[model samples]
Target: MIFNRKFGAPGLQRKKLAIISTYNENCGNASYTHVLKVAFSEIFDVDVIPLDLFLLQKPQPFINIHADAHIKSICAKLKNYDYVNIQFEAGLYGATAGAILRRMKWLIDAAPNLILTMHRVDVAETTSLIEAIGKSVRALRAGPLFHHFRNKEFSVLYHNIVLHCKEQSARKNVWIKVHAKREHRVIRDVFRFKNVIHYPLAFLNKEEQKKVKALPKADLAARFGLPQGSKLFGVFGYISNYKGIETAIKTVAQLPTDWHLVIAGSQHPQSIKAYKDVDPYLESILNLIANEDAERERKLAKLARVNHYLEKTEVVDERLTKPITDRIKFIGSLDDDDFVHVLRDIDAVVLPYIEVGQSMSGVIVLAMEAGGRVLGANNLSFAETRKYFGDTFERFDIGNHIELAQRLQAEPLEVEAARTAIFETYNIRNSVALQAQVFEGTYKNV
Candidate 1:
């Protein structure tokens, strides 16, 4: 009786797809789910089953009780769907690994055909014994048993999740989807999960693409209230220490006076304090700028004293210092429309994220899609992304501001390799077609 938009009356009896994710929230996963829900709805009878983050992330003793009840309710709705996909990130399910795994198992059992899209895969590109030893030392100093066992515990949970998916594939139908090739290789080659597939994230839908207009650089600078001739470098997304924003600041400090940094995101809601005080990370950034200003003042005062002692017309070195804070700007968080426009208009998009085992970055994809020059940290995720997106962006070592500054100062990318790759290969239409194949069991990994 229901008419499908893509197909006519009767509509080939559109298959049902239930996406299990955190919807109605300002989370990145929620945004991704929303995009997919709209796109998939044209072909399938789609439903978004919201994940209760509050209950799942409850503190201590009450967590287990509430989490179980919450998951049970979700499992009850999933049985009828032709295909169910969970946006898996581990931490979103529960505070502890055991709690997360138990709930995941319940969902696996409930769905006839399940697909797990892993947003974060804890496996490293390569293991280092020295890194393990360093963590152990830090754990000892921190005096917490949780810190000591955290890495090992996550490793166990990751393997168990993959194995569970593999086991489920044997009986009926189960698939594991990852955002990057690195994660796919790890699951298929490292953990030996045969059902794993790679699907790069699709950022700009039709509406979003329409919003992205390539404004002149002068107009963009005036809009953001910056010097007309200043070179603007920007970092987007929620403010977090892992974003490696400090490295960007340091890089700008080493650049020419005309070069400036624009931080275009505000503090994450989770990072906000109860009393409305700035979070520790945000405070650290402010203090760093303040300290730079004070250091400049101190040098100026010292120079003044030296000038007083010297003869009136003595030749002085032309080098002078100014407050670094003046060159930096915080434009705060932007809505979806402005985000794409600003990303396109900026001189370069800098991604200085430190490795936290992230499999996907929506910002990076969006940046590339907007046709901007992207400079990313040489972390595993970005390195893998370059390989996946056809070597689209330039890379600098993580936390090495000197290297980053040098890269930015050099010629901007005249060619948009990543953008071309995204448009021609990893795009929204292709992504939907691939998922359709997946749902029909006709998908093949090439």
Candidate 2:
């Protein structure tokens, strides 16, 4: 049977390829890895090795037995593969670098054809070593010194080690790869690595696409106990200060009373504290009251009236956080199906990110895939994604709550139109085919 299967095959050799990542379970990274696996599976027997280095887990035995030794073990296993491709982010820089160095050493010892793809790097906007240290110092002075110092030390050590790997690779003939054009440009500008290659990340799989399409919008609202006609707005992924959830809340307050905002995903306790600390409603009310008083003193009665009206309009917002009985819902986390269903019911996906890198948003992608429109902060990545949908999506200035509210209010009809356009452009088949091309190119080059 095996002979018959190979009888007609001409000059076929199944190459073994290894793709490495620390955050393989993370949605965005996982999605990208999944696409690459599918796209490369035909030509190469792929092995996806998810490193446990950066994960929030207990330290593994071998990992604790010196970094170089752990890396050697990893390389020893990976050495048999025909091509090794590494996907790296600064989150797991030390362990990732150790693994890369070990692989490089093994390649130098015997194996070659190693490809390093930098997913996220240690830089100012993404993850800066210096800034982390600075923040750590401040954190130390503010509270616990020993814990903060240790954490900062680990980060600094990891960053230095990763930097060593990067410099070493550049000095040697190792090829460094990046996904986006902007990433490539930044890498060139910062590190000036000669062997950098620009390759865009892949899209979702057929099954994942189907899952997105099969999302039950109405069912999701029902599960969450949200009213049927509520104008739902979704904010997905890990909650963070920079994600602009507070801004989204303020925007919701500015909307009509019937409108509802759903903050999805598990909030980091720090973020919850930060939100409580900032208290956007109070901030807005104070700003309004101050403005109104100033206007009245200036004899600008019309302006004062406008400010007063705004304040009055926002009074209902205080009721939002009364309890679960209150309309505003904070669903901590959702399963994939439930998330999809919720996404479908949403009128718009709001990503008011203050800072973003080359990260392709799964929330925006899912919203678009589920036939919902997107309202993203004005950024290069968002702009690139918006290009596919044309006029369907709208962008708001980052950190500008008033502008975000105005855009949200004005663009409901436009969002629906954009939803139609988004479906046409980001259809799963086309996205998959484009990803397949990327895989084909990468495989051929490798």
Candidate 3:
């Protein structure tokens, strides 16, 4: 009978919801789970089970991943819960689709009321005949009927996924939820999953919203060491390659000194692991990033050296070019309260991501909810955000430095108007309430 203050725990027992996630881990899905756990706590007696899906390891070097222990663990644990929700991302679970499927199949058998929320589904909007044929060939090779024949783990994954999806498609309680609309279309149209749930990703709790609105206008110059009265633009979350950080960096160099860029975060620990495990090709790309980051560091060091030399000589060396890289600053990662406070402080939040296999972005939702002007890449996720939230955001071509720069140079969004659209359209409570209600209906019918 422990009573929670923020969200009252009812005297009578509430329905149980077991959220299966790497709750202690740092990932976008984990963050989302934390938010949902808080938001939905009012309705259900919520509990979390740490499913260390991404921490999969092989029995031996270059041998197959020993996923059976995890499978058995999930099946046993989930049977006791009234309802189970899996914060699923295929890549986050296993190295390949087949590897992930093996884990999911266990859940499909164990919990009838299991709901899987997929974060990524790569179904290109259009395809060539050859591409279609190639996919079909792969599907046949990887399908559960033929998975045993495939030599490499990678080749069999997608095909087996299609087979597993088809098998689970007819299950009433086994709901496939996705965050974006286009992803919903792909599930329904491409995979022929008629029961796909187009659930909107929610962010910012009532307390966080109150905190954001009550945030005092702080001295940004002193706090983050930026110039006084500079119009601060920001990029949030972990620094990654496809995140288009280079474009943002280059774009910052072109902007006026008054238009400062504040990178209000660092690389997340889990993301560092994801970079290592997900793709071998990404290793070479990351080496290039390391080189680029080194170059930036050198510029900063050189700026210091040149400034020190000039202080004594009191004259510019004619051969040396003066550096104008002072405005770009990287404030290390902040906790949730500080993140909201910092997000509330910024003039705009820029998402300059290149086209990639993301179903949706949690940042866009959070930024919109925080009542700031959002500038996002013109892709499926951002486009959906614009379509739903109206002029709360603007779009630029993905990785297009000139276009991104042009958008930044444009007049800033009116604060009151942006706040209005965001609060009115997509607050945390409304989205969560809708989800809980719909989820209850599913429970009843199931």
Best by TM-score: 1
Tell me each candidate's RMSD, in Å, in order: 4.1, 8.7, 7.9
lDDT of all predictions, in order shown? 0.79, 0.56, 0.65
Q: Indicate the worst ten consecutive residues by lDDT in candidate 2.
A: 1-10
Q: What TM-score does each of the candidates earn?
A: 0.87, 0.64, 0.75
Ranking by lDDT: 1, 3, 2
Q: Write the per-residue lDDT of candidate 2 for residues 1-446, one digit (tens) a residue.
A: 00112212458777777777643454455656666676566556888876655321223446545644544566677767776666655444243333444344443333234566666443443335556567768876533444444445444443443454455564443455655556565556665554556543435434565566665446455666876666667688766655777667666545665566677876442223433665443355335434433543454445457769877533333323333223456787666556666666677788988764544455766665555667889876666555455655668888787887677667464355545444544444443333333333432332
Q: What would you estimate as the lDDT of candidate 2?
A: 0.56
Candidate 3 residue-wise lDDT, 1-446, digit = tens: 11122345457567788887777555667778888888778777788877655455332324334456766777798767777777776655665555577777777667656567777666533444555557668777534323223323433453355446557646645666777788777777877766567656778765676667776766676787766787788888877766777777667555665776787766655345533664433354345445545665676668778879877534433212323346667787777667766676787788988765566788877776766678888876677666556666778888787887788888866656656645654566665565555455632322
Deviation of model 1 at 110, angstroms: 1.1
Among all windows of 10 consecutive residues in model 1, the one with the lowest summed lDDT is 1-10
Q: Which residue pairs clash within candidate 3?
A: none
* TM-score of model 2 (CA atoms): 0.64
The all-Cα superposition gives candidate 3 an RMSD in Å to the true structure of 7.9
**Position 129, candidate 1: lDDT:** 56
Ranking by TM-score: 1, 3, 2
Name the candidate, 2 or 3, with the larger TM-score value: 3
